[model samples]
Target: MRMMDRRTKIWILVLVVFCALCAGAFLILRGIGGDGTVAVISVDGEELDRIDLSRVKESYDIEIDTGYGRNVVHVEPGAISVTEADCPDKICVAMGRLQGSGIPIICMPHHLIIAIEGDGIDG
Candidate 1:
């Protein structure tokens, strides 16, 4: 019984240390940034439009007619998203908005990608 209790305590201490290391690693790796608040829209691997979301004083809708299909993008003060799409899956529309610099809004069928470009290190 004494040996079993000691083994359990050792395992618990190891687990705690491992968890702490993982948490610290996550915080460090999550500090990556993009260049600014500009949204770069691309279709079929070609640059289509670049909209600066920060300078967008009024909300507007941009209708994109790609060779594959059509996608309606909505631009707000600080965000951009595909509000409507003709793709069968409609996954791009369901993505809602682009708020972070991690993943870009992708339309697989239309081969369209909307990525947020960071202006500087602070963005």
Candidate 2:
């Protein structure tokens, strides 16, 4: 066993504090996501459709058929997700639903993308 010197202890404390601060900043930024009500669907860098999830009263399914493949996007109130995908991996379908502006659902084989964006934050 070895005892840490005073300088090593101070440096360790500094590192711990810095890490704590970084974690705090990350949490704050993550919590302050965009207004997350409008979902934008795109295929191969081309905009296809935009749906306001906030105004959705009943859930609906949107089928996106590209030349590459197909994906079924399920839309619910305040959220959207890919319920089915023809891609081999089917990762998009496994992503469930997007709650905020964290990540976009993507189907690489189909070149389909569904991203949530902020319309405006209401006070």
Candidate 3:
């Protein structure tokens, strides 16, 4: 077996430290965008509404009618969803409520996207 020289050991240490820092940064940034507190609604890539889910007290529905089609968004404390939509596929309604920073609810037929975003984060 061959022993590593002092310079080789130092280089290896530097590489380990660099990798550790990169991993730490990646974890911190991932958590920063997790468990979002707001919901953003958009159509055709244009923002239509931003709702603070944390402050919501009562559940309600929003009617969105655009050139593409129509959607009914249900909003409640800490969550939002598309309860009804006129799109042919109805995939947005099937997506269910927005939870955390997972996949967003999208209505491709209507060009609508409902996404959850963390504080100060835009979707």
Candidate 4:
């Protein structure tokens, strides 16, 4: 009976440790980025397009028509920036270059979002 009780206690401890590790991993990954395909770009919560890694351009510019105004998206080598926005405060442009896969560039006034995502196996 004593041996059985010790084994059970050990198992419980092991299970608790495993759960903690899993939780830690979850939080860490969430902070850095998502595990799978996140979002590349979305407008008004409606995804307009995705950035194709294979077809990634060294430099490109995007113009968004927010109905209320216009937002220009610019991406250069190693960095991306927003040049112009019709918003009262140019917070999105001030965000500077964005390279994280989880976090996205959000223009609340325009309801536009841009993010980095992993290429699907099929992609």
Candidate 5:
């Protein structure tokens, strides 16, 4: 077996420390923007509704009919999604459920934006 030189061992230790710090930062940032419990629904830059998913006990649907188009929002327990839409691409409906506080569900044709907002994690 060959022993690593002093410089090589120091470099390896520095690399390990750097990786640990990076992982810590990532975890902290992820926790800061954890899975949100509040969902905000908007259309054409107008704030329409805000639902707290944590308090939801039953599943329901909200129909949004704007001048641009129409969309059906489904809310259940701790999740929200666009189940139906009249847009040309139908991308919003295909976005599935809102997961955490990351990318929001957007419908460009209808000018709709559904986003989850909060710093607290969903239990």
Candidate 6:
């Protein structure tokens, strides 16, 4: 079997270490999302509403309706959740409180989706 030269061995070790470090950084950063300027609300891949969470409370439990009926959502500090939904089963509401920012509370029956958006998004 052929053996690698000293320089080649050193280079390979460096590359492996670099790759491991990169992977570690990625995992760490993925957990620490940026406090960007906007948080969007969407449903079924369609943009429904936009909210500005800047200066917003650590947690919130609010309701939104389009003149038809009422729905409830619970927004915990840094995250939002649906407590009780007007829809049957209230599955979304029962899903428990969301503990993250950048996500949304969605109700498919009403074609409604709520996401966390920044002040930059248009009405």
Instruction: List TM-score per model, in order.
Output: 0.70, 0.70, 0.70, 0.59, 0.69, 0.45
For all candidates in order, the CA lDDT equals: 0.84, 0.82, 0.86, 0.68, 0.85, 0.58
The deviation in Å at residue 58 for candidate 3 is 0.4
Ranking by lDDT: 3, 5, 1, 2, 4, 6
Candidate 2 lDDT, 1-123, residue by residue in tens = 699999999999999999999999877755565757788898987889999888999999988898899889889988999998889999999878887765678888898888877544221
The total number of steric clashes, by the backbone 3 Å criterion, in model 2 comes to 0
Which regions in candidate 1 have their CA more than 4 angstroms from the true location?
1-31, 119-123
Superior by lDDT: candidate 2 or candidate 6: 2
Give the per-residue lDDT digits (tens) of candidate 3, residues 37-65.
77888887789999989999999999999
CA deviation > 4 Å runs, candidate 4: 1-39, 118-123
> Candidate 5: misplaced stretches above 4 Å?
1-32, 120-123
lDDT of 5 by residue, 17-62 (tens): 9999999987786667667778988887688999999999999999
Candidate 3 backbone clash number: 0
* Candidate 2 segments whose C-alpha is farther than 4 A from its true place: 1-33, 119-123
The TM-score that candidate 2 achieves is 0.70
Across 14-118, the per-residue lDDT of candidate 1 in tens digits comes to 999999999897765444545357888999768899898889999999999999999999999989999999999999999889865646799999999998875
lDDT of 4 at 87: 94
lDDT of 2 at 103: 63
Query: Distance (Å) between predicted and true CA of 47, model 3?
Result: 0.9
Deviation in angstroms for 26 in model 2? 7.2
